[model samples]
Target: MEFGYHHSSFATHDDRSPAAALVDRAQRLEDDGFEWLSLMDHLWQLPFHGHRDEAFVECYSGLSAVAAVTDEITLSALVTCVHYRNPVYLAKVVSSLDALSEGRAVLGIGAGWYEDEYDAMDMEFPPADERIRQLRDAIQLCETVWTEDSPASYDGEYYDVDDLYLNPKPDDIPVLVGGGGEQLTLRLTAEYADWWNLPGVTPEEYDHKLSVLREHCENAGRDYDEIETTVTIPTIIRDDTDAAHEVYEDLLEETDEDTTPRDEFRGLIGTPAEVAAGIEEYQALDVDRFQIGVPKNDPETIDRFVDDVMGEF
Candidate 1:
């Protein structure tokens, strides 16, 4: 399976500027054989990651900076909230990044979550059903902007564009939808998404979700194999098993208690061989990619993962 790096925290860069640390990590990830890199799209840090006061960068802007620094690694937000920006504007932003990066951009989007962020930003957090509908509209609108000729018009339930002209169209940016809602989300993924991602799920859960997705694809009259599947797992790797577990415990101590429950959290915390075995479990289920989230952007863990586990696949 292809491996990607997902950056979720900017709070642990000791003496270096956040930008410097990000650039350094991006370059290293690219050099170390990561196929892609993603940043969490959050205005406030997620509770499990840290306190809301911790440093967090805007998603697209951070992606733009990384684009300038790396030549090869594909860049994306782990999942942009559909309600944060108008679809027309988002299409332009992503298209611009694709042009600047010479065609290495993927639009990973989802229905907005994290109610605390909404309240803090003074944006309305609509109900789940409405957000999911908006998510579909946003996807359709963006696709129209990218594929339709100039002066395109789309009338979506939550977004509308009239005679809009999007210049410098992207070189076919893939749409990756994140979330695993059994009903609407999976149906939408079958209908529109080129890639579907669900994080923090055990192998059994992933299998069940895949079955639901396949059923949705059938009902939608779409080819199930057309969509790529990805999973994100919080990872901590060390040469020693005990050391890896120690680091995992330290990470738990540093983060909020609202994190995924221990029994449900499908994180990888062990030696290279053990982590590789965990990855193989997903690989066996036909997952196309694995997005590894290293706690606090730990460089040593990232390096060990690349030097050891990656080669095992």
Candidate 2:
């Protein structure tokens, strides 16, 4: 399986800056054995475990900073929200970032979630139905901007742009989408997304989603296996703590839904053997990529993942 490190960028009250710790994690992800690194995109800071707004980093700026320091691992937004920005500008930004990283970038997109984030920031968070349409249009726009030399024009209910030009197109950059919505989302993913990421979902759910995706692909006249399957699992690997299993269990209780995201991954609990066994279970569901998150950003957890779980894999 292709392995990647995923973390929420948060500030700690005790000491040091969020940027330093984030860089530390990215550097270690490369130093150890991860193929890629991803960070979530958000406008307003949400409530973390304890501190609400102290430690979160701006998504685009931090990602650029990470690209500046790392060369071994690919960098990407875990999933950029569709309703978050203008499609044309974001297309340019994504293409530029891919070029800057020498083609080591993935564009992961999603229909927007978290209404509070939009409401508080005074951005329009359209209803789910409209958001799906918006996502489709955004993908169309991004693809056009990347592949076309002449000005691109698009007309949709949610998006209408004319004669927009982008230069220095990226080479072989992939667009990933996160969702399993059977109607628009999965169909669009089958049609466009290079990777389909399922977050904090059970192997059964993942299998079900993949089934739906396959059906969508069939309907769309696309190959079922063309879009790769990825898993973003909330993980905790404790090197030498009696708290190994409990950490995963308690993390859900402590962190809020908006911040922690995808609360269903509590199965990351248990001993290394048990977690490894669980990983195998997930692998059985045909996961192409696994982006596992470390609890508390502990170096030992990273070591445990590389030494115990990934080593066995």
Candidate 3:
């Protein structure tokens, strides 16, 4: 059970410059034994997680800054929306990051969601099926740009590249498709992705989704074991179980109750020992990695997690 730090919010660092805070946090995470690091790709904080007016940094830019400061920790967006940027440009951006990081880049992508963001940005928010198809097209375009030689041409339904020349090509950027849509998204994962991630799911839900992915792999004539499986677990750790619960309650108070239901705040929310036990449950399921989302990036909680729970694993 390898651990990754999922940097989901910047609200707590409002007093300081985001660059200073992000660099400091990235360095600390690498020193603290986190093998992977991810950031949320959003124009604004998600309604369920924080207030809309909170600080939000662009995804790839944050990863680029972290890349300059850290070594060894794999960096990525938890999931970049397909519609956010042109596929060709996105390929170049990620390739640049891979080159700068010396090949520690993973493209974690998904179909566009958050209709409110779409409206705010004046971007088209297509239907679910169309968005999934667009996501597939985007993945195909990126793969061609990253792998094939220069003067590559790809004809995808949503995007097309004619005589595209991508220089300084990256060496195999792993594609981690995010989402648990039983039909289209799982099929896309089986057909193309090197990794599949589903965040905020229960153990039972994860089991069911894994089974679906296996079926999709079989249908697609792909090996299920070839794809790495990762889950983002929203975690809160404290010295004692009661203290952890108090922290969880405080987080709930900050979040929008209408968007975030109480039950949705599921994951390792307890003392180090209790959190360690919960992690073992997922480890028993053969999960390849756990992306721990420590809300607000609390220093004490992060230290306790790395020192106590992660050490036990």
Candidate 4:
């Protein structure tokens, strides 16, 4: 499976400026054999990663910066929150990035979650079903804007567009839909997305989700092989198992000792060799790519992963 790196931790290290660390990590990941470099599209730091007040950069701006610094790696949000930007505007932003990156932009998006971000930023946090409706509508709107040559209009319950014109469309940018909701989300992925993300799921769970996604594809009259399957997972890699545990402990201490995202990934931790085995288990179920988050944005962990796990792949 191809490997993607998620720059999930934006808190500056005490040793260097935040900008320096971020650039260094992005460039290094590219040089180290990561195919894609992604950032989370959250304004506030999630509680599982660190204090909510810690440094967090805007998603698109940081992705542009990352695109500028890296030469070959594809750049995108792990999944942009649909509620944060208008669909037409977001389409322009994504196509612009594709232009600037020479067609290396992937649109990874999902139904908005993280109510705390919405509450803090005064953005509407609609009910879950309503948000899913918006997500479906936004995907349709984005696809319409990117492909239509003449003026286009859309009328949906959550969104409406009239004579929307988008110029300089992207060159077939891939749409990667994140989230594993068994109903609308999967159906939308089957109908609209080029890639489907199975985040934080075990092998058995991924197998089940794949079955559901295939059913959706069949019902939608879509070819299942056309949609790539990806997994968004937390990867903790070290030279030894004991050292990896130490790194995990350090991450807990930084987050007020909270054990959310860390706890969520307990089943996926190991040395590089062990991690490779874990990844192979997923590959057996036809997972095509992995987007792995390096805890604390540790560069060494990434380097080890490349040298040890990715090399095996």
Candidate 4 residue-wise lDDT, 58-162, digit = tens: 888888888888889988888999988988899889988988888899999999888877888898888878888898888888887788775878787777888
Query: How far off is model 2, as Cα RMSD?
Result: 2.9
1-313 in candidate 3: lDDT tens per residue? 7889899877554577766798888998899889999998889888668778877889999999999999899999889989889999999999999998999999999997889889998988999999999999999999998888998889989899988889899978999999999989999999999999999888888999999999999999999999999999888898777788778777756766543344564678888888888888788889999889887776678888988888787
Which whole-number lDDT from 0 to 100 does residue 300 have in model 3? 72
- Which model is ahead, 2 or 4, in terms of lDDT? 4
- Each candidate's TM vs. the true structure? 0.96, 0.90, 0.96, 0.93
Question: Alpha carbon lDDT of residue 260, candidate 2?
Answer: 37
Clash totals, every prediction: 0, 1, 0, 0
Candidate 1 residue lDDT tens string, 53-135: 77778888888999998999999998999877878899999999999899999999999888887887899999888999999
User: Which pairs in model 1 have colliding backbones?
Assistant: none
Q: Global lDDT for candidate 2?
A: 0.76
Which one wins by lDDT: 1 or 2? 1
Clash count for candidate 4 is 0
> For each candidate, what is the lDDT?
0.87, 0.76, 0.87, 0.82
Q: Which residue pairs clash in candidate 3? A: none
